[model samples]
Target chain A: MALKLYYDLMSQPSRSLYILLKYANCNFESKLLALRKGEHFGEEFTAINRLQKVPVIDHNGFVLTESVAIIKYLSRENLIPDSIYPKASKQAARVEEFLEWHHAGLRLHCAMFFRVKFLIPSIVGQPEEPKNIDGYLRRMEAALKEFDTKWLGRGNNFITGNTVTVADLFAACEVEQPKMAGYNPCEKFENINVWLKKVRDHFNPYYDEAHEVLNKIGKNKFKMASKV
Target chain B: MALKLYYDLMSQPSRSLYILLKYANCNFESKLLALRKGEHFGEEFTAINRLQKVPVIDHNGFVLTESVAIIKYLSRENLIPDSIYPKASKQAARVEEFLEWHHAGLRLHCAMFFRVKFLIPSIVGQPEEPKNIDGYLRRMEAALKEFDTKWLGRGNNFITGNTVTVADLFAACEVEQPKMAGYNPCEKFENINVWLKKVRDHFNPYYDEAHEVLNKIGKNKFKMASKV
Candidate 1:
């Protein structure tokens, strides 16, 4: 019996997991939980995740929620790495640091990205506000600058160093947005572009499928609108 | 060289780590990163954690951010139980799941708590905004009610299972807000109170230490003024 993933392609992390699973060749059943339709909050869906969030998973009798954890779980279950983890005890802690901060820091950018682009019009029924997006872009730009100055070393592939941690994948998928939102990515943070290219070069096969999924998010003609 | 943690007592996660460190007896040099002074945004501090957030561990050359990651590092360093992580893969994954969800769901209560009780006065300079507090309390009440209905499994000690995983510590410390906020813990949910007491009993030393540090917050005596 394969584990079931409750996901939405429109979600960044969900798209992430979709990419990850495609690469790993894992056969977990994909159950689409559409947030646009508020399917995540339904009683049946709530039974799977009491918290009523997307990107939940059920493996055997055990159930889990939260995308980062689900990604890590899948990573560990497959051939991802302990390299994404710290080699030394302290480095492992730093990975955790990034993951935790990712929630408040990088992840905030993704939410702001969607909210400004898609959410206000479709979900919140508000005009696409520039100032709100400007504020978030400032934060994302600051984070990218820090990524260049602090976390990204002189020559490293991933966020916590080389070897493609989930942090890299997480950051790469998110940074792809500034351009999509008409906020030039390369101009904002040069190193972020460099790091992003590195992530894509190594993770490109994964991205081939993911880009298709992400492209469908705004444009309805792709596979997303046609399928569940 | 003991790891140095720069933190303010008043911070939700900083207090959480302070308690964890105390209970575990980790060799860590503690520094108070006072939020009241906007010390977190200072150049020197941002150099330590570019996120400019607290509960970071500078271990030798590597700086780790995020309290959840720090806790796991402590666990691997054997400050806590190996059983907390367990040898079983799925079981360990469950722990991470709870920790991941901890931020999204549980921390909303803290967000509301800070926005109402702390930020309104601290940022907006408003005095005793009962309406702000009521908004937070109502949200917390709803989350806790759901937690009771879905999460608790008849006297489960921690969020995941019987043992005091990192999840329990994070949840317990956050739930302690009720005492300070003058909100009723038992008015709606029985399980949260039960879980609270369980962790408090098992991790009393850490719990009590955090309480001592946190009790000092919001008091005017301690250089409690903002520079930023």
Candidate 2:
């Protein structure tokens, strides 16, 4: 059963699936792409995924994109345990609920803030407009506020429930992105800070492993800013 | 099994799920909310869903939101036929791929275009800035182009395959929205135009019935513009 995962750790969804695959103990070849270097646009990668996005999987030639879909697909194939992705109809729906909401909610806001505040400036060799940064930051904060109140506010240990599920993994990964832009969500949102630590601790080694590159970049970004 | 669906027919996802439920012949109680009436904000509706969004379902007291999640949950419980949602792993992934992509792709752009061009203007009782409409229209057009060339361009009759699936329903509903703003996709993209017709014909009465409110609004919008 040849399974291969093409991902970039810098990408939030890519890191989420990477941590998931590792936690699930699924044996798959990791084909990493450097987003900064424009590797995803290469002919080879484009052939694999015409969308030219990361977090794609090729399982014995049945290719799939979209981290949410891929995670669920893996769960259906039993590569990931039901504990991580519940099979019980209602339990699973709870996880699915968050996954679907996050697409336009937390994921969109966090990714946008990261891109506008950190990525675009770095790539273009100049800082983005303060107004643009502030706009995206506000949207990100509003999304985070909703995330803190609606999802974690339920008083559960995690997004869906006490146990860490794929929902937590996806959320935590997205929450970590703005850190690269020197935005600390943990500083403002108490529940998010606590839940994030819990999720990271739950999947440690793999979680940290998947984020190694991003953490390095984040630290470097902070150090450079401090020096400036 | 008591299944209750709280939805606004004007909402695209709500319409998609409404049509799916009807097509599947599921006995469901429809709790329609007139979104423009601020009914979703009332205390009674807030008690049902604090998010105040339509396309929510309460199945035997287990409430779920997010149309994609609701559809999948129903499919898992056998409320939706496999032909519509597909049970096979690969086939299901294909449908899921489009659903996930559309969240930020077609859905975001199309919804934004509709809001900027029509809904926002009507709600505020004034016209929006032409620049705003142009920007959103450009994004929507780009998204529609990708939707056409990538999703429907594979010479397949539908988004995922030859037969209509949940993916097609979601896309068709989203595609129909820009019409309210006087944007006719059929005139620009032949593939989308054909596929939309096929999907609507397949689901017939349900598809047209669910679209009744939006279509009426669209017609009035056109008539008013022509008069102007």
Candidate 3:
């Protein structure tokens, strides 16, 4: 049986996982889950992942959730090269550092911004609160600053170092999320701006394919202004 | 040169790393930072980690932050044994899942509860907002319920399975943080109650030593209603 991947491209983590699996050319069956329709809440999907979150994988009856974990698992399974996560302890540690920092830092702020600015208004039919959005925006910018100055560091091509790792993929999905909501990430942070373009080139077709939904939304609603 | 760890025991992540290092019996020097005194903001500490967070490790001048990352790094460096993290790919992925889910789930809520219920009132000389605390309490309860039902499972001795992993260590620090503020974790969730005791027993002297400051706080001010 092939590995089963449950995902939704609209989700940042899912996009990262999808891009990783596709980029690695792993033999996995894709399971599309639409968040707007509450498809994940259905009993069938919930049974696979009680948390009902996307980017879950089931390989030979062994199930796993959490994008970072899934990606790491794939790497360990030899589905992808160790360079993506690094087998060298210190280099691996650097990637892990970026990932852990990402959850509380960038991921949190970007999700908050997306929920308040885009999801609630467009999906939930709720009025977008400018005050709430503004607070999230400020926090998001602060997180970006940290990403640019601290994590990316001075003269580093990628977050951990010269090579593009899973950290870059996870970051690209999250930092790019706010762009769909009319927030320009690159305009505010030069380093992330440059780094993102490099990551884009590295991931190539998989990145573009995984981000199809987001790109469509960007072209239609956001005027594709986020492409910078 | 021995690894130098910068930590404040009162902080959850710091406590996790501190407990891990001590439990592993790794050769390391402790650099304690008093978070309550704003010492982390000082130029000296900020130079090591610009984010100014505790639970940072400098291994022969290779500085690393984020407790999960540090723990993973230590595991990779063979400073700790693989049983704590598991060298097997699938088992390791399960541990990683718990850690990643942990940051967004329990850690976020418990930290929020601790901040609103205890930190702001004690450190900032601000009044505790019952409404805010109540909101956090509800969310914390939901997170605990999910953790107990989903992660702990029906008859698993540990989170992933029979063996105790680093996930248990990180969880012990975060989940116990609220106890000092008078929140009873065991009273609310039966599974968590059982699991926590097992984790506490696993760490023993190190757990007690690392949590001494919090224990003192619970003893003096909070009245310690959280003992299961």
Candidate 4:
């Protein structure tokens, strides 16, 4: 039986998981739960994840939520190569460190920027509030600066040392999210810019495919023409 | 040489790491970083962690940060029994899922509530901002409710499943931090109230010892006498 992945491409984590699953070349069922249509909040979907968050996976009888956990779990279950998630405890710990820091660091700031700049104005029919996004933008900027200086080690191919681990995929998806608002937050950081391209190129078709919906939305200038 | 642990008891993650280290019965050198004195932001600490966050560890010269990652790394390094963090991939993923969700969920809300309700007012010599705490309190309440209803299985002892994993230790620390402000948010939730005692009792002297500073600060009503 194939693994069942419940996701919505518009979600940053969902896109990361999509790319991960595709890259792993695993047999999985893709179940789209559109957030714009309130599909995720529906009773049917609630049975899968009461939290109503995306990028959940149901393998065999085991069900898991949280993109990082799902990716780590799937990595082990599918016997994915160590280069992606790593098997060595120390290497894995480095990846874990990035994953843990990401939640409050890049993930929070990027999502906040996207929500304030695009999601709110488009969905709520309200004008963009400068004060609302000011803090998020500042935090986003700080996080990006740290990502370049601290996490992105000198000449390191990925966030956690050499190979592109799950951390890179999750981060790239989040950093790309604010771009939907037509603003590239990491545009000034040379290292981040270079690393972003490396991650995108490594994932290739899967990355582009997973981001198609978001790209279309971004290209449309995040207008309220579409519900989500 | 004992593993070096850099921590601040007042910080939630720092306390979590302290309890985990003691519970594992491992030899570790405790290096207290007084946040109130601006120790974490100093030059010496910056060399250890550019982010200047607490709850970092140096084991055999391999320095690591992020409480969840540090705990996970230590769990493997010390060969602690599975009952604490677990070895099975499925079981481990559940713990990871909780830890990840915690960063944005309980940990965020709890820490924010503490900062707004106690830290900012006491330290900055400003009045407690009720408006700032409102959203955080609501989110904290919602997180606790979901934690009890969804994560805490009926009749189950811990967050994920039967055994108390690393998630419980980290969670108990965060949930308890707000108590220093003379507010026990989880006191209203029956399951959490029960689980709280269970987790607290499981760790015993170590749990109580790790919380000594915060407990004293909490007892003094978080007066501005100390800078933190």
Candidate 5:
């Protein structure tokens, strides 16, 4: 089976899928897109994906977009373990619930905070105003609180239950995003910190490898902010 | 098999599932919540769903949230048809792709437009500022343009393909939402109007039934605006 993945590590969902594929021991062609350089919008990539989003897959000739959809497709083909995405109705629903909620919940607030605090400022070559930064921070914190109380407070080893699933990976990536903006989620949400560590420990080198670019950028951002 | 669905017709996903259940001929006890009356926030409903969102399900003792997850669970149990949510990998991926994208793309923009232009104003007892309304409209229109070009323009009679799947149901509900704010999508986007008509015709009676409340509110809002 000829499979090709187009992704950017800087993107959270992209990283989540990257780690998932690695964990599954699936070998496929990696067609990385440099999102910061606007490569996703070019004619070639746009032809591959009309949506022009990263974390898309081309299996043989069939192309699929959306990370969650791609992951489910892969699971259906038996390319990924059932443990990562269960086949049982109830167990699978638990994971699916988190995946669906993640879009508008953790993902939205975390992405918004990162954009307003780090991405926009870097692109425009200026710091964001305190009020705008605070607004996004508040939203991010509220989502984090929900994640802590509702998700982790379930007293499971992961988001859905004792076993780690894609839900945990997806949530961890989103929580890690605002680190580039000098906001550490672990500092505020204790349960999230513990759960994140467990997910990272399970994924190991793959998790760290997928986040290399983000971690470097985050460290640099912190150093620069400290100097200012 | 004791099954119950907690939903509000005013909620898009709730209506989507409601129609899906009816379309599948599944017998489910309806537990409707009046969102306008803040019924979802009551202690009784809160115990059923910690998220306090509609479109939740209880099967025996198992409780599930999120419409997409609930639909998938139902499909897994053979409670729904293969035509509605294809089990074949490639075909199912097509439906999953639309479902995944719907959350952040069409749903977000359309809901934002409705909230800003109608819901908030109704609750606050005043009209929204023109600037705020314009901002959300632009975002919603951009999302609609993408939907028209990328989704409906794929040369298929429906969002995924010729068959009217749950994807069409979810998309149609979101597209219908802005009508409450006096935004008729059919007027601006010809393709959406045609595709929407097809979905409505395919699932009529049930479609019309699920949308009764929204349609009434939409007409009343239009009448109120006309008087102004």
Candidate 6:
């Protein structure tokens, strides 16, 4: 049996995982879990994940979830670069560091964008809170500034001083969400735009397939976030 | 030069890294990045970690930050067993699953507990929004229920299935925070209570000796949280 990747394109992490798997050329059965349709919350999915979420990877009988860990696990298998997690223990520590901060910073901003523009409007039936959205956008720009000034550290393919690691997967997928949700990521942070382009082309031809489906959301104010 | 840990006891992740390092008997220099004093935001500290946060590790010239990444990086050095991260991709994925969910669930509770009960009261001189606290607590408790029911599987001594993984370290530290901020963890969860005990015996002793200056709060409520 091939490795099975359970995910939904709607989820940022799941999309990251899907891209990684696709980029690595890992042959696996793709399980589409649309949480909007309540597939992830179903009993069968619950039995497998218990968390009732997507971006789950099951190898035969063994099951695993969490995109970061899964990405590292896959990377170790020569799917991506072996250096994705860092070569030295201390370097690996930096990778871990970015991973830790990424959640609260990049992850939060991207999620907030989707929540404001997409989730609230489409699912929750709530109008966007401009104040909240503005707050999140400001934070997103700040993160990109910090990313440009600090983690960019002279620019690598990923956030932690170059080389495509889980960081890129995270940064790309997350930053893309705002676009899907109708926000301009490229215009807001030009540095992030460069980073995104590098990431988009780093794997080259690799992410084209994923980006095709991902780019369906119209480019409007959303393109203003990152200055490409 | 021994490994150097730049930390602030007040930060949950820094404390977790400290405890994990101490428990492993890893020889390291301890440096305080005083957040209260605004020391972490300095140019000097920023060079150490661009994120300007604690829970950072420095081995010689190499630097790394983020508590979970730091702990896993240290634990991987063979202080703990391989069973922690698990060599299997699927098992490793499970660790990521918990860690990712941890950011939203456990970390949120811990952050809210600190922000509302302590930081707000201590710094801004205002009580936190009660509704905010209650909402997070209720959500956290519900998450705990789901974790206990399905995630724990058939084990003891850790947050995940059987052995202590990065999950436990991330969780135990976060769980302890609510107690320090005046939330009782032992309100009803039996498994969480039992598990907290193991962490206390395992990690508390280390913090006792190494973190001598800090008037660490919440041991009593740790007992409360572990009421089972």
Strongest candidate by DockQ: 5
C-alpha lDDT of candidate 5 relative to the true structure: 0.91
Alpha-carbon DockQ of candidate 4: 0.82
DockQ of each: 0.53, 0.88, 0.84, 0.82, 0.92, 0.57
- Candidate models: Cα lDDT each: 0.68, 0.92, 0.86, 0.84, 0.91, 0.70
lDDT of 4 by residue, B155-197 (tens): 7899887788889988899888888776775668888888988
Candidate 1 per-residue lDDT over residues A117-155, each given as its tens digit: 656655666657767567776777776666666667556
Docking quality of model 1: it rates as medium
The weakest ten consecutive residues by lDDT in model 5 chain A span A131-140
Runs with alpha carbons beyond 4 Å of true place in candidate 3: A223-228, B224-228
What TM-score does each model's chain B reach against the true chain B?
0.83, 0.97, 0.94, 0.92, 0.97, 0.80
Candidate ordering by lDDT (highest first)? 2, 5, 3, 4, 6, 1
In the range A1-228, model 5's lDDT, one tens digit per residue, is 588889999899999988998999998899999998999999999999989999899988999999999998999989889988898878999999999999998999999999999898989999889986888888889999999999898878899889999999999999999998899899999999899899999998899999998899889978988999
Candidate 5 shows a clash count of 0
| Winner of 4 and 6 under TM-score | 4
Q: How well does candidate 3 reproduce the true complex, by DockQ?
A: 0.84
The C-alpha stretches of model 1 lying farther than 4 A from their native spots are A1-3, A42-44, A78-91, A124-155, A177-187, A216-228, B41-47, B83-87, B123-148, B153-155, B177-189, B216-228
Query: Model 5 segments beyond 4 Å from truth?
Result: none
Instruction: Give the alpha carbon lDDT tens digit for every residue of A1-228 in model 6.
Output: 558999878788887777777766678897887787898878899888866777888866667777776776666556565555455665666676777778876787678767776777777676677776787677767776676667664646567665677677677877777776666567767777778888888655756556665576645434644454
Write model 3 residue lDDT over A17-92, tens digit each, in one string.
Answer: 8888888878788888888899999999999998999889999899999988887788778887787878788888
* Per-residue lDDT over A87-113 for candidate 4, one digit per residue giving the tens place of the 0 to 100 score: 789999999899989999888988988
Per-residue CA lDDT of model 2 for B1-228, tens digit only, reads 599999998899999998999999999997989899999999998898888898899999999999999999999999999998999989999999999999998999999999889898989999998976888999999999999999998989999878889999999999999998888888899899888899999999999998897788888888988999
Q: Write the per-residue lDDT of candidate 5 for residues B1-228, one digit (tens) a residue.
A: 588999988889998998988988999998989999999899999998999998899988899999988888988889889988898999999999999998999999999999999899999999989987888999999999999999998898999888999899999999999998888898999899999999999888899999887888889988988999
lDDT of 5 at A135: 80
Which of the two candidates, 1 or 5, achieves a greater DockQ against the reference?
Answer: 5
Give the C-alpha miss distance for residue A1 in model 5, angstroms. 6.5
